[model samples]
Target: MIGTSEIILIFGIVIFWIPVILLIYLSIRYLINRSKKVHEEKTALDILKERYAKGEITKEEFEEIKKTLDSA
Candidate 1:
């Protein structure tokens, strides 16, 4: 059988430490999700610009895509 002091310590840890640990875990998870969301929020035009800057697309292709984006 557990002693009274041990029972009190266990209860205190259960009531306080559990929530504290959970809060920390949730906060880290939320921050990671938020960062990923920000990265995924890049627009089509932004991607086009990146491709053009990287020389992955020709000037003609860039202009064509830009015109298409503008018409939309």
Candidate 2:
């Protein structure tokens, strides 16, 4: 009981929504990855600060390592 026009309309709607769905999915994935990276960087910086506080490394060494971590 389906007409040709209805079939074409369904196809058009699917094509239009496919990319929209893909974009939404990709954006969410990118945001999640970015959030994880930021968390990891902050954790590294906190650990570095803790090491400095514990007297494991000198100020100069802490600064140098912090600079390296930030650059990465």
Candidate 3:
């Protein structure tokens, strides 16, 4: 049979680990989300290049926009 002291000790251990586990889980989740955000984010120049490659914009327009972006 479990005694009061053992029960208290078990409860204390569980209480201690709860926060430790939560911190680790949160850290991992934060890192994963941070990495996903980085991967999904795209620069304006990258989008411009994609559009130019698709022939959606003329070379002159591409150069004009690129110049505006560079100056800004």
Badly placed stretches (over 4 Å) of model 1 are 1-5, 8-12
Q: Residues 1-72, candidate 3, lDDT per residue (tens digit)?
A: 999999999999999999999999999999999999999988899999999999999999999999999999
Displacement of the residue 33 alpha carbon in candidate 3, Å: 2.7
Candidates 2 and 3 compared by lDDT, better number: 3
Q: Residue 15 of candidate 1: its Cα lDDT? A: 100
lDDT of 2 by residue, 1-72 (tens): 999999999999999999999999999999999999987775788989999999999999999999999899
Single out the weakest 10-residue window by summed lDDT for candidate 1. 35-44
Q: Between candidates 2 and 3, name the one with more favorable TM-score.
A: 3
Best by TM-score: 3
For each candidate, give its TM-score against the true structure. 0.66, 0.59, 0.70
- TM-score order of candidates, top first: 3, 1, 2
Error of 2 at 55 (Å): 15
How far is 63's C-alpha from truth in model 2 (Å)?
Answer: 13
The sequence of per-residue lDDT tens digits that candidate 1 reaches over residues 2-36 is 99999999999899989899999999999999999
Give the clash total for candidate 3.
Answer: 0
